[model samples]
Target: MFSDLDEQLASTLRHRAGGDIDPTPIVTRARARGRRLALRRRGLIAGGVAAACVALTSVVLAIPGIRGTDDRVVPATALLLPQAQSGAPVRPGEVGADPATVHFSTDPLVSDAEYATWRSGRGIESVEFRGPSGGSRFALARTEVLLNELQQTLSSAGRPQPRSDVRVGDRPGVAWFDRSGDRQLWFVRWQPAAGLWAQLDTYATSRDEAAGTASRVRFDGAHRCVVPFRLGSLPPGGRLLECSVTFGRSAPGSFIEGALVVGDDSGRWLTVRAQVAPNGSEARRGDLVAGPYRARRQGSDVLEMVVMPCVVEAFRKGWGDGYTEAEGLAILGGYQPAADLDRPDTW
Candidate 1:
């Protein structure tokens, strides 16, 4: 029943897919080189995609998550550093506004330098303490929480929906969203074993009008901190899981059709083609599974490393560094690490 619909949808996407295909060979070769470069880099690092940052921030803020406190929250500078020689609390909000002053804890699980670099690029303006509900206390920027709130809202509105289990670098996560609409967005959150707070957001605005408006707000937003990740810390033999929903523009450009891809680091890949039936049912048409593909790493340092060529390519194409880790892991699907790889199971 769905085969006919699948073929129709595939035919509709043929042009876009074909254009996308033309770059595959070149991308494959570049990805091979990128992988080797990433391995040589030897530490998990984040990249900087200037354009994507703007889009991501806008989408995150627009969603319904948390509206950060404007005046009540205390900045990171106000908090006493664990090893500070002086007992005095630094003036609140002062240090946070200066990229140079914001520092990630020097714990082995966290990279101060990487955090600093991310803060410098993002221009973080303030840090706020959220909760100590029980024994857990989180120190996230007011903006970060705000973005999370936006994502939650979008998720609640059913604009962007969760699809499957996946990994961002070595961290486990889930993927969601529909493309081809005015607002196309996806997100993944990686909770590290080291007990640090971090998250990744990937969003796209295909409509020119929405893109223009979102771009303005995103660029003008106050918070600009980049979340940091430790890719090299992943267990050498760890596996990656990836699931994606691809959207295609409908005839006359009225709507988008989507498909699903589920793959794992164990070298298994599955593609489930889907379409919205006239009755509003999500019709699954065809399925394809293949695998045992090799994975690649890129970059010379943690500050520049790129894992997962496909994701890197997307970032380079304009997705931004923030999404690179998640995109790479998604591209790799099931990426099994070598025996030498070792990542801790618990934070």
Candidate 2:
């Protein structure tokens, strides 16, 4: 009996000393419990934020500028901190306004898809004026773009003709013409400001016409509106990287399509667009419903939300970015039209 007691006591001491304890399972269980606690904490925080948004939205909707029609409740995004920074206001001779009402090619020279790809690569801003045959292309550029025009022309397959220093009104600039197949390409590069320049291009056109068109470009930088929508509750660590907003032109002027883009630190993006659809076309393609909004998942990473003429799209980086289906709905629910739809937008 004494020997049996000694054996039992020795076993107890070994057990107490953790000699037989399997630490791997204990560590794993502890880790799992910690993860659960963390998830619960995050859920509570999100819930609190959602409640606050609801309370704030009530007060925001009452504001006169943000009031919406009966069918559309104003979006709740107007009350958030601004993510867009103001830039220099549009001055005279900006790319949008031109003194001469010159006609451009009616045919599209570059497809929208092609332009989007090229523009993204160049990191430049431009406007595409589409016509029946071909459209004109205008861009705001730096002086280096002007200086390198000759080299860029030579690099192309087109045979470059004589290059000349020309004057557009009071400003001196460079002009060059190139022959490619049956088309004659005219390019006029001129300075609109001390450090800023503008490039105008046309096919089968004249240097004078291009220069005249370039002179009339006007930009008004004042009066940009904020994106009225934000993520109702942002994904963890989400932050704004870049944003662009444009307002559609009112009637009596050519229909100007508008767009908004918001990029985040998560390598994701949100885009909003307002454009005319052909009569008798369907607007809502999304079957998923977020309140009154219709939303749909496009492919694996994109969430598309349709609001009548305007379509908003959100992109995800990866699963860890936390932009789940529920989060996507919350973002769509946060959208509201800007109070000043007629005002100039930050692009």
Candidate 3:
């Protein structure tokens, strides 16, 4: 499935790069590939569920067999899954597996050839995504958001923020002290068709704490590393149909919130919350998943609608002082009205 998507992506990139390319063919290929992938994943999940059901049935039947053991001895173990012991108490931390430890960086400019060369030396695998606004300016808007957050954090901590330098991957980027007094470094590089950003931070705490934080950063980085672009240009007569939002706050006072909006024919718009996790995972609670709703025609336009209170609360907690009216509109896919959508002041 990934191979097929990669081919479609390559074809689309060719068209976007102006090599006498047409996108219709690529889009067709991608749609087909996506369908197949989804089906395959669903099948796997179904199979697992079915197996668990069968195992449960076997155990149930075995209970009757145990009563007749004097007449015909039957082993109870034969009727159960390997892990099912009738009298054993389950232990904590033995159910779900321990989370993996990993680290992630947040610099967005690691696409220069020089930076790529450096990363290759460091045994890191990197991939690039091409965007519409030329390679240099692609995702600049999202990067600006990150930069703003970094600046705010630095100022709050009374740390010196340096002028961001464009450097090759091999060279160490900028350095700054974080809110917790950790030293942070950043690097940038360019790739053939995309750019790269790399960041490294070292805390004064123990290795275990640092590793845990790094794991969180890695998860957060994975989510934040992607370039944000409109899925498609807004179609004529398109109207906003629905909006979903989410917000979450970590124990450490970090927070994140996000929203997704859908229009009748305007594709989708996404607004991401700004709290960075060490592992680059999606915000735990402030995630909104919407859609599968019917669109309605409003004159020449189409519309859909969704209202989720839990998701909005997550955003409220995460946005804190940084939230603004304009940002709220973007978060709600440009449809949420000032009066209809609840705000903190109103609450």
- Top lDDT hit: 2
lDDT (CA) per prediction: 0.26, 0.41, 0.25
Candidate 2 lDDT score at position 105: 17
Error of 1 at 241 (Å): 38
lDDT at residue 262 of model 3 (Cα atoms) = 27
Candidate 1 has its poorest 10 consecutive residues by lDDT at 246-255
lDDT string for model 2 (37-97, tens) is 4434644666521110110111112222222211223332222112223335443333223
Error of 3 at 327 (Å): 16
Provide TM-scores for the models. 0.20, 0.46, 0.23
lDDT of 1 by residue, 1-347 (tens): 22223333434454565433223222322322333343334322433111111011111211112211111222222111122222333332332333323333312111111111122212222121111110111122324443354213121234555566655445554545444245464444433333222333334332232222222211111322221112232224332121111111111111111112233345433332211222111222112211233223223111111221112111211112222344444433343222211111110
The C-alpha stretches of model 1 lying farther than 4 A from their native spots are: 1-147, 150-158, 178-183, 204-347
Question: TM-score for model 1?
Answer: 0.20
* Residue-level lDDT for 155 in candidate 3: 14
lDDT string, candidate 3, 1-347, tens digits: 23224334654666574643334234433433343344346446665211101111122222322221112223322221121222332222221111111112222322211101000101122222111211111111112223233212111244434544333223423434334334332222122112233333333233333323222222122111111112232234433232211111111110112222223333332222211122211233222222221122112211212332112211212112233333333333433322322222111
